[model samples]
Target chain A: MINVKQEIINSIKEITVGHDIQEFIEEVLLSDLGIDSIKYVELLVSIEEKCDVEFDESDLGADALKSLGDLINLVNKTLEQKVS
Target chain B: MKQYEVKNVPRYFEPHVNDCFANAYATVLSYMGNNPNFILTDYLNFMYDEQTEHIGINFFFRATPTVEFSEEELNSSLELAYLPATSMFNKTSPIDEVTDKDKVQINMYIHEDQDIAFTRLKERIDENKPVIVAVDLFYMHFHRAYQREHGLHAIIVTGYDEEKRTLKIIDKYKLSSSDFDGEISMDEMSQSRLSECPLNNPMVGEYKREIRNLWMEIDIDPDFKMNVERIYSIILESCKRMKGQREVLGHECGLNRMEAFRKDLLLKKESFMDRKLDERETYLFKTYYNSAFKSISRSRMRFKVFLEESNLAEKEDLGEVLEQLENALKRWDICANLSLKLGIKKSIKLVDDIVRQLSSIIDIEGEIINKLTDISLTRDLVTVSKNIKDQEM
Candidate 1:
């Protein structure tokens, strides 16, 4: 009974400070949120550690991480695969 | 399949300074039993093109090609240098197929699945072939700082063992002292090869014969002189091209680009004061500064080597020119260190002083080049007269 979205939001908060979690929308670009290339990697590592899920090489490609929604969907998909 | 690794792969460190494409190409040549140094000198001779970009603040120098040397130039040089090597793969296409050439061939193989790519790579390694792979630096443990960023890098896979699930890789970075040779897990290797952030292009170079009697057919003295002329022309044109131009980030070339970089430091300082300096800008500043510093340092090193190897190091005027170049390089090092230690604000203050020093060095370099050109032309005339007299006799 893990709240995957909440877990992701919490992980994002820990990695990036000063961002209002409630205002985070699915359509907002990660770059607009000040998540640069290096910071984006850090966020991915943080989420992996918090969720205890390892992203596959295919999952980490450029096409997989376009926006907040994309990242959230990826985490959910990986979580589902883990449970199965 | 039997496990194997190629011996005497030329290890080129100084990743921050030397071009990785050149280093990887050198490694392949060394593995094929060729003198990497001689080949590198020959290749660098033809790589410079006199292209100028007018950025707003200053003219940027675009002297060298950002990509590898053209396939025709590279392949023909291999043949001319008597290396018994030929490249059959097309440069425009992605990893397609391996075509056999004389004694060695450059191969590219593309597979959508990571496992398939690893399988193909392992097949080559089993045959004692060292593969040159284009990988995203983010997945490499050695370059963790660049994680998730699509920084493409080249490395040689020398050996692999299925039982141990490890692959032997050679990476040269940070001066000759930091050459890397170790076993990374098969998983890491596969991920690096299959990274899609950057285009997934996996290339493996295979060499069979050891090159003996390493001789370059081109007349060393005249060719070297021509290279020197080319270098001087590029630098001189860059200096003159800076008139009434605004500084631009991506468009600046040569010394003009260096001046534009100084302007960037001042702008960065303003951004820092406003608390608007982000991680990306910081990363770009460091990259541009290092590249500018390394270009000058590498040029100085190349010329010094050329002079020493050609037995011209003892020339009184040329020796003085070398000393001037060394002093300029030292000042550049100091400027770089100062910028790193004291943030942008203090460093911006030193920019004008450093630019003036660099301009003076360029003027001195131009004078020395004029002297060298005179000497070269005189020697050529003397040789022509001797040849004519011999023919008449």
Candidate 2:
């Protein structure tokens, strides 16, 4: 299986399509990435599609997504759970 | 190729006021330089009716994102706020009955016939009136929603080329919010005007209205005079309105509605406190909360402008009011932003923060009302003094 970290990065790039903020540092706050409310919805949806795992829209990984690193970790944890 | 275009239309992006309808009106008003006061001050007046559940602003400060405003409601809202409700303007506010050539008329229409619509747009452009038309962003190439999302929006159509079948749009509504103005094919414009984007973007939420070639033709007389009495009365009405609830155009509105709304928000927060929230519930909650604060925040900012523009508020009075208003505006922005975050991530922290911010906003708004009341009483005293001095002389 592809590395879950790679999958999250790819999703980030995909969401940044047609957007100005293309490159981002992992330590950057997710807010600094210019992901507005609309983009936030799109990113969450994109991450769900990319990981091939449905994120609990309610609170599963949403609260966990304050930073880029958090998103990567959340996706990894989700993937690990899937494997188990 | 036949062409009709209105030249030098001002771009519509008023700071702290992104309401498409109001900005659209600003386009033509600024172009003529006719009624700066009307454009700035006298347009938006707060109206809250306790009889119903309508606690929002007048037509000019309204949009079609989370709410579908009816024609009657639109007219009545203006009438209650500060106007006698003119004809069919999709985006309108308080229309003052000014003297001389400084007359403003708004005519709204929903045409099923594209040809008829084109003819009307051309007719207005010929008179230098930049028409504000309702549109669905999905059909417009410039918008990110082109073929992606369907949400109702407004744009200014300034020109058209017959052979190319293109309309020049200055879509400055929420320019910071991913909306852009660009030329579009007549077919795209027509389709957008008559669109039914049932699956609208979840972010902006869905509206229960039809676009259907709906457009507003604004006829502003090139000479405008500030109606201080009218502006003063509207402010006075707001001072009375903030005290309690009253029915204005069938919507239960007032500053009191905000507390009730705040309580509702608290309930929603508690419901999602220790429980997994439903997706639709979250979306609806976010949409409803944002729409309210968006209008409320916008309305207060405009009120601040209105007060300053009227030249009625003394410098000291205006200073204190503006500072407090600006603070409250910032807090409303914070609350709205937090509400959206709460929608994304169910957090009691976000809820508590919004509740705290909103409570402060209410207090600041109360102080604003009292200050405005003092100004009004001062104005009345001056008016009576002038009359008595004239009699004594």
Candidate 3:
């Protein structure tokens, strides 16, 4: 029931200043947007704080989140485990 | 508008996102050789620099955004200070390493007229040669920094579509295996080139160069060998610089700079205590954190590969150095990750832990230098000091 997609968009909106919020589609590759590794970490931390989901070290490795869909999937999986 | 492209312009795989100039240079060389072996690691490119400026809120702590080697240090090197050259662009690269006599030489085309540069770029492409172009992505809509972040990034322009007014480009610097091999309108590319993009990076400190219509071309011999030995010399040169970090070019160098960095971070504990860093502060810390990680961890890995590639693989201390480097390399990653996390969390404990890690890295680097020096001396390798004397003579 948690709107993880909206939450992720909201985190992105929080980081993005000056520009109006563009629609961030799920299949969009984060790299295409030029999100470097450090910025990616900030985004992860922002999402963790907002969604109350902690990303494990395995999830934080360079290969972890490829696309917005992948991040959403990871967060949803973590959220699922939290309820269980 | 018309359409033209240099076919098979290569892409660089080892780009660390911020290293566009290096990537563009390598791509040109790789395209020249048409060899996968030419795609080498940038282990030789690292340099040491520490800032004299201090963090604003806490003037006691140095702003020290330079945990990694970058172009700023490259530009600061005394030998190449003969910049402000007879051209519209003053950017220099390590093309000398790969400058094969009668085989390869990098040439720059610059003009007071932006159209001249554009015409030159088109000429090279028409001749089936890819052109390396400098552009400020802020003015270019095809880039993420469009009207957002202002900085100069080198891109390889392969083709021009006259009717569509587009240019096919290869901008491979991306986040983790991501790349761009596509088209941008000529208007977009021209605008990017013409805009005066003051280098906005904290490390490079406001390099306000004319980005207008400057492009580079390299004439290559079909039988050119990839300069792997240049990498070997550069590797040794980098180590010698580390050994001589105390030689006083300016502010603190090598481990001494690291110590200052540690003390600063530790001192920032009270100011940064449990406070989430604002986005502006986060960006600065992020630059330092990411740069340090790439410069140390990735460079060491490539150095290990170099040892394996060279005759040094037979040496007794080879395995020892490799194993120790591997261990230290992991710690650099861990430290960098902690630093990244610290940007958000702002914890004092993390600062202490990073300092501990820094101390370990410094010790390891010192030992590695000693070991590498012994190896280089035994191998009769030419060192950086020798290179300087040779240059002077």
Candidate 4:
């Protein structure tokens, strides 16, 4: 079984699909990776499919996905809650 | 005003006519059952409702006629036969009073063998007179069936085209007079029977009546979000099956349909391998995949060119033109960036080329739209732009 940290990272990688993760993290959200509202929805959808978990809108807050660590932490908390 | 015969319809509405019949029938059902201004969800809901007593609804927008006909049939039903009902409604929004300063009259009895209503609608157009036609082709199809089913003799000649001799009249199911070799004979129409009344054979009349209700009653809600979830689900499901087949073979056999068809496929297959990738690695994959997919989808330059041609041909209102252009750019960016990330190099080039061409048209459309800004004009333009965009794809 994949851990929450790895799952979130995998989700991020899946979102990027081609390049290195750090480069994507720096360029995609901070600069313009062309992430519009629709694309964001698509990203969430892909994550949900890959992880087999539904993400609440609240969990998808802008601040929650600001950095790699924050995203990993959010996923861990969500997965822990799911397990409990 | 041109006249054409309707025959060789699909098995869906076999021996009836085109897909328009099914679409029209649905429209009628929707119209009869639901309140006006209902959204697409409401439209789907009305269709899903199973109650036989409830009216069925369906609708069609901007459909082209299929069959070809003669000048006589075209002239006889110009105003009453061949015009879009929406155009008439759009022109006279207050609903009631419409001027008939340029109306033409034709001698219906003059054609002994042909239908009077059909003849007049066709004949009038031969003289070059504009007509207000009903936009409900769905209505036309159902009404035609209803007439044949119910033996109804009455026919309403709805519209006609002066230039083409096309008559857009609704005899029973709102079928145009031109769709037939000879206008539906009133005597023949009257003799037709509905296997039994609604009180007797509910099934027979049910389909026809349900369709009729949709056209008359259903209202389309302006706000519609096209859900691509269903498409995505299908794609993902196919991917899953393919992956499952690959895992079962365990590198012993090669990829083929036989692997998937094997009876023990599920048992032999392995699960999606679990991997302990870090946060950064996961992010990279997701980003790349999303971008790649977008780029692949947006790479069609023909679609962009079609949109431009449609805009020019239709000369739709400017505000709408600008709005569509902006939406196109948004879509382009989403799809193009995704393609680049996906490692679909060909798709990236296609997306880039389309985006460049589209950008120029967007600028031109934007300028035109900005120069003219009236509420009415803007609304009309938006409608036109939306129609063009939907059809372009």
Please name the candidate that would achieve the greatest lDDT relative to the true structure.
2
Write the number of the candidate with greater lDDT, choosing between 2 and 4. Answer: 2
Cα lDDT tens digits for candidate 3, B1-393: 567878777677663322566577668877876432223333222233334323210011223222122333333322111122224433354432334432345555566576667776787788888888878778766666779777667789899887888889898865323267888887887788777665555434555666546676766555565454554564466565565443332433445555666677677665777676656556545556645565567556656665666554436877787777777777777676777776666544667767788788778877777787677665554556678789999
Docking class of 1: incorrect
Q: Provide the interface RMSD of candidate 1 in angstroms, 1 decimal place.
A: 14.6
B1-393 per-residue lDDT for model 2 (tens digits):
688788878775775554666677677667766544344443233443333223355432233432234546544333112222224322244332332343455555665677777787887787777888888888878876788777777788898899988889888766335456667889888888878656543434455556667777655454545567766767776776676544555544456766776776677677777777666556554665556665667667777776666676476777898899888777776666666666755555667778888788778888888888798899899999999999999
lDDT of 4 by residue, A1-84 (tens): 765545545555665534355432422351144333334455555555666765543353232354455555555666677788
Whole-model lDDT values for every prediction: 0.49, 0.64, 0.61, 0.31
Off by over 4 Å in 1: A1-84, B10-17, B42-129, B142-150, B175-179, B198-286, B312-317, B338-343
Best-fitting candidate, measured by DockQ? 3
On DockQ, who's better, 2 or 4?
Answer: 2
Comparison by TM-score, 2 against 3, better one: 2
Report the C-alpha lDDT of model 1 over A1-84, residue by residue, as the tens digit. Answer: 666677777767876767767654788777656564335555665677778886553343222477888888888888889889
Arrange candidates by lDDT, highest first: which order?
Answer: 2, 3, 1, 4
Q: Tens digits of per-residue lDDT for model 1 on B56-163? A: 112122322122333443442221132212222333553323232222334333345565456656666665556777665677777633464555567788888777
Model 1 per-residue lDDT at B180: 68
Q: For model 3, what is the error of residue A6's alpha carbon versus the real structure, in angstroms, after optimal superposition?
A: 12
Go through the candidates in order and give each one's DockQ: 0.02, 0.07, 0.36, 0.02
Worst 10 residues of 1 chain A by lDDT: A55-64
